[model samples]
Every structure is written in C-alpha cells, then in structure tokens.
Target: MVDADQTFVIVGGGLAGAKAAETLRAEGFTGRVILICDERDHPYERPPLSKGYLLGKEERESVFVHEPAWYAAHDIELHLGQTVDAIDRSAKTVRFGDDGTAVRYDKLLLATGAEPRRLDIPGTDLAGVHHLRRLAHAERLKHVLTNLGRDNGHLVIAGAGWIGLEVAAAAREYGAEVTVVHSGPTPLHSVLGPELGQLFAELHREHGVRFHFGARLTEITGQDGMVLAARTDDGEEHPAHDVLAAIGAAPRTHLAEAAGLEIADPAHGGGIVVDERLRTSDPDIHAAGDVVSFPHALFDTRLRVEHWANALNGGPAAARAMLGHDVTYDRVPYFFSDQYDLGMEYSGWAPPGSYDQVVIRGDAGKREFVAFWVKENRVLAGMNVNVWNVTDTIQRLIRGRARVNTEHLADPHIPLEDLAP
Candidate 1:
C-alpha cells in the first residue's frame, strides 16, 4: 500500500520511461512523477533516427513522444539534460550530475537503456569514423554526408544488423558508395534466419551495395586526419572515406550494479535480470526496456530484446506492477525496419536451432514474403518482408499461441487469418 503523495523517480527519458510515466498517470496514480533524461530533447522515438530522420524525411520535432507543454499539463516533471551519476539504494536516492541533485523516490524505474557498441580496432577514434545512437550522432553524420559530395564519398558500415542496413540504405539513396562488412554469413541471419537473410543479401547487392560477409575487421587505419582503409583478419584491405560502427549495443547497467542490484550474467548476455512482473531483485525498484533481461514464456528462454515494441509494451507493464497491480510482460514481441523502400516486420520469439519447421507465406523472389518459424505445430516466430497486414495477423496469432500446420502455412492460397487461435 503506497501513499498517493509519494514521489516516483524514473531514470532515463527514452520511450520506456516516457511510456511508464504516461501509464502511471493514465492508471490514476496521482503521485509526483519525475522523468530524468540525459538528452536535451524530450523522450523521442529512436527507430526513425537511422531511417526517416537520417534521410531527412522526418523533422526533429516529429520524433518527440510528447510536447513539453503536455508534460507540464500532466504534472509530470521533465528533467532534461540531466545524467544520473549514481544510485544510492540504502538512501533510496539518485544523484544527478548536471545539477548535483539527489532525489529520493518511494519507487524507482530503471530505464537507462543502452549505448552503441564501439569497435575496439586500432584507429577507430580517428576522424570520419562515427557511431549512431543519439540525434547528435545523426546530425553529425548528416553534415558529413552533405559536405563529402554524395557521389564520391565511400561509406563503410561495420555491421549487418537493422541499424547498419538502414544507414546503408539511406547512404545509398544519397548516391554514396556504400559497403557493409559483417561477420555473419548473411545480413540479419541471426534474426530472420539464413534463408530469408540470403534474400536480403540479394536485394542489397541488386541495389549496388557491396558486402563482405564473414569478414572480420582487424583494424581501421587513418591517413591525414581521415579514415583511409580498413584491414580485415583475412589479410584484405578495403578503402573508405568514412566508417560507421554498428556492432550493436549493450545495456547501461553500471548504476544498477553499483546499487547492489542483481545483474544478468554475460552468459545470458549483458543486462539487468528481472522477473516476469518487471520487478528487479528489490521490489521497490523496477526495470524495463532494453536494459532488462526476462524470461520469455513463448520461447521458454530468457531474452533481452532492444526493440521499440518491447519498450512500449514492457514499460506500461512495469508501471502496473509498480502501482501494486502485477501484470506479466508476456506480449508477443514485434519490431520493424525500413530499408530502401522495403518494410520488414518481425514477431514472436525464436531461439537458435529451436524451430523445426519454417514456411514462407508469399513469393520470396518477388520481394514480399512472410517466413514462419514453427516448433511442434505451434507458431514460434515470424518475419515478414514488405508484407504489413500479414505481420499484424501474425502478431495476434503469436499472442494467442496459435498452433498451425506448416503445410497450410506454406500454401499462399490458405488465408493466414484462418490460423488464428
């Protein structure tokens, strides 16, 4: 039983934190809620940064979750440009750096999120080498692209994940010579599986994007204040004018660990460990979004998904638990990526080597298809490329834990809606 006057301090003002604050207010919790964000801007959507924002198709103001006036009207205090330096669990306070303010909370939500992983290779700190995470990063990249003369600049991306591919697509659209170096056998192989990944490889190649699959970069060399070349472990060198490191991201968990909270093992991958109810080891503190690892009932495994859908859905679930109404974060995970006029949607969970059956719902050669991962007649996961409606149907089917015959799933004539539970 918590008092209505008690304060709730939410660290990190990304989508998760903003959604939690909104959920708290919507659920009729009239306590003092303060959202602390490190960025100058209010909580903004990050997925568009690599695609629409990078391509200049979306305005900066369009990224914000809510207007500043909205927060003021809702009585939610927005602490912009403030970084949480430390967490004092014993004192139930968080120390911020910008103002050196120590705020105590009756309840705290950790949504510090993640930072872009950097390449440890030599000369990675040189000029013309960058990593995209914040709006500042995108602005810097945009400046570089604008000044470098799109027709002549060579952009080298160091990963094949969604961010790397999206950035590559934007760069290609601007007429930059784009090349992606990935250690994986195919782009998005780990997420979409090999067969579908192969299709993406062909698509990118057809668009004049070069790929170095299974190639590991050993070092980045700079010449005369600019990135000159990248050397690979296989003794090959590739010339480049700019380098973008998109190796992935790790959870920002230092503050949580310093506060004596149980952290997830690196074996389970790096992130804080949380229960199904989104509560950490300390019930007074909760965690959600990309920073927390929790068990997935569908996959029968623990996963830390750094997707927009997870942040949006899990944040509200955490708020429910904080307000003494425990709700499991069991929604089927979904995410999207826009690359080169193609939209991709992924739903459900699929552990490596777990799916025994895979069915393609449409023509893969035509650049529109839905690949379903099935285990023991149950739809475990799905990835749809350029098929929007199928993704929505798959999302509902996943939530219902629908079981379907793989044979019918492969037949394009069989309506996917009929597979509903």
Candidate 2:
C-alpha cells in the first residue's frame, strides 16, 4: 500500500488522467499528486471535438474535464506543455525533454492515450489538411470550415470510421460539399456490421455527402502548399479544398517500451499489456485508458478501448489498484457516438463473427431502434440508436449473459426489464 508521503504521478491529461487525480483525492490519499500532460491546456474531453464543439453547439470552456482552478484547489501539481521523453525505471524518475526536469514518483499511472494516424500520401503536409484529435486541430478546422463557405468548399475525408462520419455530418451542417473514400464496403462495417453501417452510409448520402466504398486514396494533390484534390485508386479525382484523414489512432506506448514494460504483439493488437488490475509487468506502475491492453475478466479476451467511458472509468479503477487494492477492472466495454440525428450507445464485447444473430426491436428504417447481437441465445452486445432511456437495461442484458426470448426482445411492447433474467 502507498503511504501518505509517497508521490503519485499521473501521465496524460485527458479524461483518464483527470479522473485518476480525482480518485486519488477522493480515496483519502494525501500523497503528493502531480499530473503531467503534453498539451498546454488542462484536462478535457475529446468527443465534442468532432461533434458539438465542431458544430459550434458547445463552447470551448465546456470541453474541459474540470476548470484550471480545480487542480489548485485539489492540491495537485500541474505540469502542462511538457513531454516525458524517457522513463528511468531503475532510478524511479521521469525525464522531461524540454527543461530536462526529472520528477520522482513512488507510484506512477500512465494514461498516455492515443495519437491520430496520418496518411503517407503526398501533399499531406500542405495547408488546409486536418486531423480531428486535438483541441487545436478542431479549432483550426472549424475556422477553415466557417470561412470556406458552401459555394466552392470541398472536404475530402479518408476513412469511414466514426470520426470520419461525424466530421462529414458537421461539414454538411456547415454547408460544405463532403466526400468520403474508404476501403471498407460500408461505413463502420467492421464494428456495427454491414446492415447498420449501410444505414449510416444512407444517412450521410441523404444529407448530401458522397461516399466511395472499397476505394483507395492514391494521393492528395495540392498547389502552392494548399490542398486542391485527392486522387483514388481508379484514377478518379475529387475536389478537395480540405482533407481529413481519420484512418484511426494508435496507442501511445513509446514511454512504456523504453521502461521495458510488456507490450502486446502486433498479431495481438499491439498495445501495452497489463493484467486485470490494470497493472503492467512492473507492479509499481499502472496503465489505463487507450494505452493499456488488459485482459477482460468476463470475456477472457484482451481489450484496449478508446472510448470516453473507458477512460472515465478505467482511470479510477487503476488509481484504486495503485493504492494496493486488488482491482479486477472488469466493466463491460461501452461506447457511444453522435452523428446527424443518430445517437448510439453500445455495450459489451462484440468481437468479429462472435455473434450468431442480431435481433432488432423498434424501427430500424425510422432510425429509432435497439439492436442486440446474440451468441448461443445470450446477448453479446447491444446498441440503441436514436433511442433514449434504456442503456442500463442493455448493459444488464450483456452482463447477465442470460438467454432471453427473441420474440420478447424484438417486441417493443414487452418491457426490457421483463426480458432480464
């Protein structure tokens, strides 16, 4: 167990790091708490970057997890705009690159998060090209969209993932002509399945966004250091005043690797490997958020979730474990997304081809529905789209792992509570 005088250091200032700091204080640990983040701003949430904040529906202040004064009030030391260049495991210190300041820690928690993947195509370094992972990126993209106008604005998006789709929606709302080119057969097909992915594709098309599925982006053509067009594998080119490469993000694991921590193999999704308690190979250190790939106690599979809920919940769980608590971080994975009129909440582990069938309730065509993926008569995962007030029940069905009547599950009249075991 950690003593009161020991210094507890947290790396990464997103939702996970902030929550870990809050947990350390709430758990009555009076240790010296210090949070180190590379970003200049205080801890903030990332979802709104592509949704409300991008659409100008939310103010900049609301994006922060907590105001700047909260850290001071909570007696936490803040190290903003600093990069941890190396972890001196033998010396038990972290070295910062900028000022060469080394901070000692009795216990360390890593919530390094993930970084947006960049395309290697030509003209990627040109102006008017963006990726929506950081606050600064969103700010610049919003400014470009606001000034670009509808008449000649063409936004080319590479990747049909959630970020790509959400940005497409926001661009359309701003009256920009948008085009998405993805290698997948449909948007979000790998996760939501083709049926539901097609629904989202149709949604975007109806809103005046063009999608080219099974297409490869050959290059991003530009002139005078400004984006002009993007060419595809078929030699077809689309107008592109701006481009968003939302291919996906990779977990930040260089620090862990330098410290000789266990990292999962590329064949196994390639992330920092940890146990159920979110403890890395070194017991003195712990990792959470998108950076750590920990074994799932319920499913017997390792998972590295990049969703907001995981960071919000996993950070606290790791904090508890750092304080010498035997923690089994076994919460079913959950995530949600907002695009256009669709709001979706999904829970449980839905591995590829794991479910035998997907049962639906409500009207999918109307975009108000609940879909449950079932394997061996048990609910593996469930997603509620454009529907409100039933996330708790959906989580219960997944956690309980009980067989339910398909007819009852498919009936809107039959309450979800009645379907529970």
Candidate 3:
C-alpha cells in the first residue's frame, strides 16, 4: 500500500504513462500522481493517425484516450506542454524549462517513448516533406492532403514499413499517385520475412502504388518552395509533390541518459535497458513501452519491440513493480497492421536466421494465410494475414512450446485448435 501523499512523477503522457497512472489507481495507490506531457492535448491514439486520421475518418476528440475532465476526476495532475529539461537524481527532482520549478518524486516512471527518424537528405527542410509520429504531425499531414488535393498529386514514401504502406493506402484512396521507396528488396522484410514481403510488394503494386525495391535514396530536391524530386543512388529520380519519411523511430533516451541512468545499446535495436520487472539501472526509475530494451525468454536474447500491445502490457507491468509486486513481464509478443482491406498479425518471437522450416496454412494466393516459423521441431513464430482468429490459438501453442506436426500444419483441413497443447 502506498501512502496517500506519496508523489509519483510520470514522464511522457502517451499511452504507456496514461495506462501506468490508471493502473496505479486501480491497484489501490492513493498517491499524488503528476503526468508531464510535452504535447498540449491529452493522450491520443497514434495507430489511427496513419490510417483513419489521415483519411479524415476519425476526429481529434475521438482519438483522445480520455477527456480533460477525466484526469481531474481521477486526481491526476495533467501538466501539458511542459518539457522536463533535466533530472537531478541526487536531489530526486526534475527541472523543466526556464520556469525552474522542480518536481520531486518518490517514484518515477519514464515512458518517454520515441520520435520518428528524419531523413538527413537535402531539401528535407522543404515545406512539402513530412514525418508522422505524433498527433500534431498527423494533423499537419491531414491538412496538407485536404488543402492540396490528392487528385493527380504525387506522394513519395521513403520507407515500406507499416506506417508508410498505411499512409500509401490512404493517399491512394484519395486518387493520389503513390510511390514507395524501400532500401530493402521488399516491404516488411525484417518483420514478415522475404516470401510475405514479396507478396505485399505485389499487393501494393496491384493497387497502383509503384515500389522501388533495393533502391537507396541519396537526396530530396526542392524548387520554388515545394518538393521537386528524390534522387536515388542508382541514378533513378522520382518526381514528387509531397514526401513522407517513414524510415523508423529511435528511442527518446536523452532525458534518461542526462539523469545518469544507464541506457542499453541499440545493438538489440530497441530502447532503454530494463529488467524483467521493468526496473531501469536506477532502481527508483522504471521504464516501459517502445523505450524499453529487455531480454526475451523465447528468443533467449534481448529485443526491443514497438507495438501497441507492448505499451499496454508493459505500462501495467511497471506499475505493479513500482507498487512492490514484482512479476516477470513475459508474454508472447504480438503486433497487428491493417492495410487495404487486409489484416496482418504476428505473434511470438523469431530469432534472426534461425528458422529451418516454414508451414503454410491456408491459401496465400487468396490473400488468406498463416505461416508458421519452425526451428528444431518447435514453433518460433506465426504470421497471419487476413486471419486474426488463428492468432490466439497460435500464441497459445507457442507459449506452451507445443511441437506441431508439419503435415497437419500445412493442411487447410486441420483446425488450429487441434494443435494446441
């Protein structure tokens, strides 16, 4: 039980921070909690920003996790638009901006999250090029799409990941000419592997979105206050009116590092270093969400997973640990992406270059399939396209370490439930 006056300072008011504060209250912690967010608005859903928000299918108010009044009702001090400039670990206080007002905390949760990586090419500062990460970024892009008109407008996306593809689908729906430039051979190769990556390449091509596979971008050129063309290393030039660089995101670790907190290397390519209980090097501080780098039980190595489910799960896990109920944060990792009338879902952990066999269930040609990644007679991971229901069963089998027969796995006649342990 926490003392009624114990102050819990939570940095970053995104999904992880918001969820952690809510979980603290649910866990019977009647403490003075302060949530500091650089953004003025309340926490909003980011997933919709790339799809529905871009299409204007969702409103800003609708995307907010909770209304401003809800924070007051929960006795949470919502400090919006205030950036924490530095941390004084010796004094256990956080100093923000020129205001010099210091916030002291008995416990601190760093959910600082990450920001979208920007293209370091020429003309990147042009008015037409954008990167979507926050609600503001999405709103700006939405305004551009509405005012500029997508009909006959050329949209060039610099990365072929989920965000890039989703934005492409939305832009294409608006009758815009879309082109995806990927340095890799295909789309989502790092996550979905080569076979499914090629399938996505075909799917996007069928939708009138041109793809430049294995093409490296050298520079983004602009003229007369607008983006003109993107130059590639292979001497291929793509004319563009608007450009979006969706390369990826790097962990926001400046604050943590400035506070003298130890950070994990990007060798695992994730974020902050954390233990099973989500505790960072500084025992008083805990981290979760995309900013955390922790060891994976399934992969027997450290991994940094960026997914909505991870933020939701990890936030509460850190809260429990802070409340003195330490539990191992071990669960099958899961992620989902909705693109062009198709649902893509993945579960479990797959080590790089370790899979020896793959079992294809259902028909890939029909765009409905589940691919099982197998190694040493054990299922490592599963990717389901347009088949969400099978994810739960697959996750269960993977968690139980079930050895499924390849013959039955490849047959569409066999139900997934029968293979469950």
lDDT of each: 0.86, 0.90, 0.85
Model 2 stretches astray by more than 4 angstroms: none
What lDDT is reached at residue 39 by model 1? 92
Candidate 1 lDDT, 221-313, residue by residue in tens: 988888988888889888888999999998999989988899988777678889999989998899999999998886677889899988898
lDDT of 3: 0.85
lDDT of 3 by residue, 1-421 (tens): 6788788889988888999988988898998989998898897767888877788887778877778798889999999998999888888898874587798998899999899998887888888999998998998888766654535888889999888999888887777888899999889877767867888888888889999988867888988878988888899999988999999999999999888787887766857888889988888899998898887786787778777888888888998899899579886889888778878888987744768877789889988999888887678899898976788898887887867788888888888888888
Best by lDDT: 2
Per-residue lDDT over 204-283 for candidate 2, one digit per residue giving the tens place of the 0 to 100 score: 99999999889888899899999999999988899999999999889999999989999998666678899988989998
Sort the candidates on lDDT, descending order: 2, 1, 3
Q: Which candidate has the top score in TM-score?
A: 2
Which 10 successive residues of model 2 have the least lDDT summed?
Answer: 143-152
Question: Cα RMSDs of all predictions?
Answer: 1.5, 1.2, 1.4
In model 1, the worst 10-residue window by lDDT is: 143-152
Tell me how many clashing residue pairs each candidate has: 0, 0, 0
